[model samples]
Target: MDGQEGKATRKGPGAPRRNWRLYGVTAVGLAVVCGVAAAVGQVVRAGEASAVEAPKYAVGSGGGTKLDLPVRPTVPVTLTVYEDPRSPQSRAFAQRYAATFSHLLASGQLQINYRLVTQSDKQYGGSGAKEAAAAAACAEDQGRFAQFMDQVWQHQPAPANDALKDRNLLTGLAKKAGKINHDAFTLCVDRGQRNGWVAQSQSEFAAAGLGEAPVVQINGRPLPVPPAQLTPAELTSLVSDEAQRVATAATP
Candidate 1:
């Protein structure tokens, strides 16, 4: 997560390879899940979760980012995740917490805002990061950001491979996501409508001084621990703590 020095606001240093150890949460510590049991229709890794009739969230666009909001508003703790699609660390973080995040969204307790960046393209020497990000943006337009994101990361190539630079591969992966309109996605990729937005978003990421990919924030604050060291139960605790703080502040 080291930041590259002497870089302009448009790009930053690429994230280094790091081993994101998945810490296991003990059964006793998992008691916190009880608070949001209603959202846990069945606990399963998000990568393996079946495609549903609809998205888990009401996907939308704003501020050069994709927004995933709960079906109904509740305390509203927003998780703003800045990610470079080509970064393996970002992939690890996303997949590791997918199911926990799914439950949080289902319980109407959290909102997720995904900010896509392409620093990895500069680091890895290809347009894959940009291409993948814009494709996700197009998916957002079609209300399939969640599904596209899951499939994209699950199918991410090696950090140096840059396979996503091929439009056919990108479009093919979209098709595999199901529910997404292949024709619209293909047209979006050809037109590159979201490319500029992707660039603008990268600029914002640079300006924000965010050091690396998978930079996660809760209610506008950085996570207490690095995303790699964070476990699902710890994330749940953090979100619930934020919810309580918001609730307390509003108590009259």
Candidate 2:
């Protein structure tokens, strides 16, 4: 059943695929901004005049109203990760490598753009994935995207079919992110403020020619991982080495 964004336990290379047509959510506009999101208009890349909306998960100091990539230039690596919340592989990888990623994030050695693929909802025959994705988008609105992600992956529902549509579960996950304003975050989740964007993210991901979730690209190039090592510690090492490699290559 490891088809398209599912666990790679029983699939040949590239056998898995996303049935985007069935997902039925429209993708949002693409923005390559530096920081997260906010309730009002957000800060964009300096001197940028486009009306492009702020990225939902922009990292910044002012509760996501501002978009600033943390840390600095010793290592410049951009990691564009496309993931589906219901995908076992995606959850495994995120939690398995959380420490390493957090370190890189803190050091400003890595620039990360998380692309969500809610199409797993259709592929897996449930709305759990899509709803969880919308919850994630709500978390981003509260400037706690990364934090909420960790909790969701850490406490991932078992059985693959267990729905993530439980409001109580989602709220608990959001609280782990920080001192969140529960009322606002809850309302955002209930209303799905970023549902359209959630849909559009998958569309943009496909448009970029990345065929599936749990896909990682470094500097716009695919960062290949053998299916065998999907959960090995070596996965994190590879990412670390790639960050260094990109930094070294950019050096004068």
Query: Which tens-of-lDDT digit does each residue in 189-241 have in candidate 2?
Result: 88878789888887777677766568877778776764325654565566678
TM-score of 2: 0.63
RMSD of each: 34.8, 34.8
Worst 10 residues of 2 by lDDT: 26-35
Question: Against the true structure, what is each candidate's TM-score?
Answer: 0.71, 0.63
Question: lDDT for every model?
Answer: 0.85, 0.73
lDDT of 1 by residue, 153-178 (tens): 88999989999888988888888788
Question: What lDDT is reached at residue 72 by model 2?
Answer: 54
Q: What's the lDDT for candidate 1?
A: 0.85
* Candidate 1 segments whose C-alpha is farther than 4 A from its true place: 1-72
